[model samples]
Each structure stands twice: as C-alpha cells, then as structure tokens.
Target: MSEFRDSGTFQGERMPKRPNIVWFLAIGATLTGVAMPMGTPAIAVSAITSHPNQKSDPPSDRIAAAMRAYLRDLAAKEQFTGTALVVRRGEVLVRAAAGAADAEEDIPNRPDTVFRIASVTKQFTSMLVLKLRDRGLLGLEDRVCPYLIPGYIRTCPQAWRPITIREILTHTSGIPDIQQLPGFYIKLSQPTTTRELIQRFVNKPLDFKPGTSWKYSNSGYILAGAIIQAVTRKPYGTVLHEEITGPLSLRHTGYSRRNPPAGYAKGYFTVGSPAPPINGSQAFSATGIYANADDIVRWDRSFGAHTVAPPATVKQAFTPQAPCPSNGCLNLPSSAYAFGWLVDRLHGHRLRYHPGLLQGYAASNMYLPDDDIAVVVLSNVEETDTNGIARHLATMALKSASAHDH
Candidate 1:
C-alpha cells in the first residue's frame, strides 16, 4: 500500500544547471554488466539533450561507470537493494545491480533478477485495454458496468453504472483504493478470486462521480481486469500474455508463476527483515506483473517503435487525460494521469512514468519520450526511493550526453 503512494512522486527541487552527482546521491544501487548489443548503431548523444550536432558521441562507458559508482554506494548504505537499467535510444547505457536479492541465501541481485513490479502492472493493463479498442472489441468511452461479466459480478453497483473505460484507465473513476478498505493487508495473505476482490469495493459508494475527480484506485484497475475478462472471455492473465508479453517476446515479464522463476528476488522490509507475503492474485491487474530490467527495456522499446498498438492509440495512452494536483493522487506537481502512466515535465522534457510498490518490492519505470531515454529501477527493499534515483539517473544521462556534444 505504501508503494502505491510512494512510487511516483519526485520530491527534489527543480533541476540544477548540471548534474549534481553528490547531491543526487544523498537523495538515492550495484555495478554489474554493461551490454552494447553488436550491430546496434550509436545514438547521437546530442539528441538526448535536444542539442543538434556539435561533436561526436561520447563513450557510454563513462556514464555507465558514474552510475555504477552511484549505485554501489547506495547498496553499501542499504538504500537500494535490486536492479537498475537505463537505456537511451535503444542502447543500454547502464545495466547494474546492487545489494542482495536474497540476503539469507547470499544471492546478489542481477540485471535479470525478477521483482514483483507492483502497480507498474497498471501500464500493461492499460495497454491491454488499448489493444482491445484497437481491435474494435471495445470503445474507451463505453460504460464499464455493462461489461462486467455476470458470472463474476452478479450485478454492477448502481453507482458504477456511469463509469467509463477511459475514466478507469486515467485513474479518474473515483473508486476507493482497495488498500483503503478495512483489513486489506490481512486480505493480501489470503488467496482471493477477482470477483471476490471486486465485491470488497463494489458495494461502496463512489468516492466521487466518475470522471469528475481524480484518485489513485486499484479498484478502478480491478474493474478494468473484470471488464477485460468479460469482453475477451479469457482470464486477464491469459489475455495479457496473448496480447502484450507474448507478442513482444518479453521472456521474463508477466503474472507470477505458481513457482517462482529463476532469478526471482525475494522482497524485504527496510529494517533488514523479510516483508509480508502477498497473494499475487490479490494484486491482479493492478500490481501482479513481474519483470527484470532487460525485459522492461524491450517493453519500453515497443512504445518508441509503436509496435504494441497503432501509433495513434499509443499516443493517446501517453497523452494527458486527467489533471492531478501536486499534493493530490500522485504528489507530482503539475502532473496529469495518462492512462496507466503519469505525465509531467522534468527540466522541459516530456516525461512519462509509473511507479509500483507492493510490500517488499518497489519499482520505477520512467521514459523521456522526447529524448528516447528509459530508466527502470526495481528494488526488493520496501519504501526505497526508486523514483528519485530514476529521475537523477535520467538527468545525469541527459547532462552527460550533452557535455560530450559541447
């Protein structure tokens, strides 16, 4: 529950003139391996900062080294305990892991270590909805209640009859967050069916009329999962694989398997103890997916190439749909909720990102679409500031690249 609230907001003041590496370090991971796939052409470093041709591209190794040192320091301090990957224009600039994935077992985190990505799952769920719309199977403006499968939800609450698919996607549906409900934590320990989870919030009155206000509610995504199930006549997980991960060949990204996969990172609390266990099904469409840095990089590429959906649909997913105040929902100043992603400006860059937290795991997936930079930080340590680290890395990447241009 803390993850949902803690993941997206960036608390640092405005960007400084240059990379304040030390200062950012105070704000924020390991040195692992760096890969530059063969035959991959070098991206113009100048383009990253939107500065036209000036000089030749700089070696990415320098930036990677800086990032490695930064992460190594964090891990030593027990601030970050997982993996971090930064990609610029399809090139892996930084791929590193710090701290332990399973401390008791002496397992170190790696670039391929899978962590429960929590609400980062929301973006994928939103993509699923967009794909459905692309196939003409549904419309974003369609009423949500009509699509609730009778087998699962006997009746849609009267108050829910007016909500729209678009509203849910944008977190403007006003359904109370499932975590806000009584005994939600206890419920996480128990295996619950999607319908059962829906029932917990279905009878509750709307926090506000759908689309009239904005709120971060897993209930909205839960309803989304139900709606997807209703229309596809397949389980949400099945549909997710068939539509997104399968198509992308995202080898390590999807709902948790009955048995944890190889490289699975065990989560932990900040106090160096094991975090409470959670039933993956309980998180469902909102926070159930697991993926490593490599898989996430590929997922990010799909967006840049417009391969997941038609270019128009992808554009809509990134476009601002609902205004969120700095102190409200996401605590991101001048931010707007765009489908499952949050949109904001960082030093004039078009930044699109989502953060996820569930018990011991925290994840931050950020993209500077304009600059073609993607930063993914996944940690098993609960409450870690992966978002701040991501923003700092992004700024550093841009600044470092720009320096080379000069």
Candidate 2:
C-alpha cells in the first residue's frame, strides 16, 4: 500500500523554464512550420538558475536538502532501495540515490544507475504511436486488424474485424491482460519476439468491445510496438533511439537485449524461493527499457518544456479516452492509467504517472503538471512499493517546493 502525506498547503508555483536547446528546437520548428513533435511546456526562466555544470545544485537548494534527509530516513527504515530524482522546471532540484544498485556487490546506488523501467516503457511506445499519427503514417481511428497479423479478431465475438490505434493506446482494445496468459511468468525464461507473442494469443477472445471501456493490457502496447515495426520497417528499439532517446541525449536509456550496464540491479521474484535474475530481453516492447532517475528527470523536463511531441499530442496521451468501468473516468483519487501514464490527483495537483514491475525490478515515474514537478523511483527488489516511495518523496518534494516559493 502507498502512503502519501502533504504536510503543508501552499499556492502553486510558476512553471519552470526550458533549457536553451529546447527553446532553439521549438523556435526552429516553428520557423520552418514543421510541427515540433516534442510536447514539453515552457515556463518562466526564473524557475531555473543557470549554471555551467548541469550537475551543480540549484540556487535555492532547500528542496534538495529536504529530499536528501527524507531519503536517508527512508533508506534507514528499509522503505526505499533505489534512486529518486525531483526536478522543478528544467533545474535539477533534488537528485539522490539510496540503498544499493547491486545488493550482492554492496555497490552504493548513484543517480546514474540504470534499472529496468518495466511498464514505464509503455509511454515510449505510446509516444511512437503519437509520432506516427502526427506524420500521417497512421491514425488513431485506423483499425488494428488491418495492420496486425490476420485472424486477430477470430477469437473475439464482440471484437470487430479491427481495433483502432487509439483503442490500443488507451487500453480499450478489449485484449486480455498479459497476466492472464498461460505461463506468462514462466515463459519469461524463453526468448520470445513481439510477433511470436502476438501470434500465440491474438486469436484469443476480447474481454470487451474496443473503446467501450478501459483495461490495463500490456498486449495492446506490445501490439502498438509491433505496429511501429510494421509501418517503419525498423526494430522498435531503433525507432525509440532515433526518435526519442538519442535526440534527448538520454544516454542511460535503452532497450537492452543482452548485457546491461555495470552496477545494474538484478531482478528477482520471491516465489517459492527467490527467483534468479531476469534479463531485459524478456520484456521486449511491453517493458524492457533501462534508465536511471536522472535520465527520467530529463524525460520529464522534455515533457514539461514541450521539447519532444507537440503539446496537443502530449495532451491527447494524458487525457482520459474511454471511461474505466470502475471509475467511469480517468480522474480518480488513486492513479488511473492514461495512454502511457497513470493519471491521478495528489494534494490538488494533477499527475501523469506510470509504474513498472518485473521479476526482480520495480519502478515508477510521474509528472505533476500543476507544480512543474517530476518524480522517478527505480528499485531492484521485484515486489517493492516503488509507487509508494515515489508518492512519499513527491509529497515531500512538493511541500518543499511550496515552502521555497513562499
């Protein structure tokens, strides 16, 4: 269970400024009349203090100091075992790592340590879908069956011949959850491609009609990744690197297939006994992206500054598409899954968030648009409450930011 507490109430602060690179791209794209696919927002430049070294602490370091103390307490309590990054506008406000990157090796966690992002990778896949739509290569309204392998609709009585890209993006395609698949957890040891995985279960019946309701389906995002491949004739990793990671200089982020970086945490499942390390290759498009807290802060800044996709596209991704049967809308107290994010409200702040879980890894990333704050938590323990840790830290960060603003 996650615990979130906002100790003090304060007015919202101004949105932070974008880096020069973001401004240059935005202006260049605007001048060329080329749509800047970046969806980051522009805030007042005062939110961030300029410095020669990007790693240098900000001018008002109260937030960072508070966060560090909080993290130290959390680590001492065994409540967190990963890196946490809190940034406002484009400045690195609080960047701290706790616990161990490699628990067995006794290596201390660092801000640059990479962990498997798990379902957080969905956002990247969703971004690719939006990019394709912007380029006219695809449409949210387009049917999925036409682009997918044949007989995809054979198993679903309610499923029409096709599912839309929009349906898949919003998890309304009525596809069965990946957890429901037979031997899904056990099959992680085997090498499986996106095509093979889809072929194995594409004919399965739909849980509901496309777009009628929302359900969290990893299969839909996997299919979305496959769609990227089918249209671009390139691997999903290549597309992700060229389109998103490379441009942003997210050097620590990647879809690792074989060897991962040194000091990386090993994934483990505490089944009957502790399970062995899970490889990144097992996750493929559905998960598999590796990154650290600092890199994700860069990602959030890009979103906050409108540096990647246009603001309109980013809005579409965050906006609730179809109603969730239980909640009736994406606006709920706890996190409600958006296209690639878990949409929610905290202390009157709107958030776009997502959490990732694998055999031995857990992660969470969230963007609070109201306060221009983004929090990312990455852990090695498989079933650890990463979201809870993120929320706790986020609450603290927001409180500190509010105090600083006053």
Cα lDDT of model 2 overall? Answer: 0.65
**Model 1 TM-score relative to the real fold:** 0.84
**202: Cα error in model 2, Å:** 1.2
lDDT, candidate 2, 1-406, per-residue tens: 1111111111111222210101111111111111112122222222334433434333345555566566666766666666666665544455545554544444445455578888889888888889888998889898776676542223433364667888887888888877568888887766666666776567688888776777778888877887898888788789989989888777777886654566465564431124565555557777878876666777776765677789998888788665555653323344445678767788888877888887777888888876777788887767667788788778876776677677
lDDT of each: 0.73, 0.65
Off by over 4 Å in 2: 1-63, 150-160, 270-274, 325-336
> Model 2: what TM-score?
0.79
Write model 1 residue lDDT over 1-406, tens digit each, in one string. 0001111111212222221112111000111122222122222221234224333345555676587677767766777777787877655666655656666665555456678899999999999999898888999999887787576678877888888999988888888999889988887866888888988988888889888888889988988888888889998879988998888777677785242465477888773688877678888888888887767767776776876788898898899999886574477544788888888777888888998888888999998877777899999888788888998898877876566457
Worst 10 residues of 2 by lDDT: 19-28
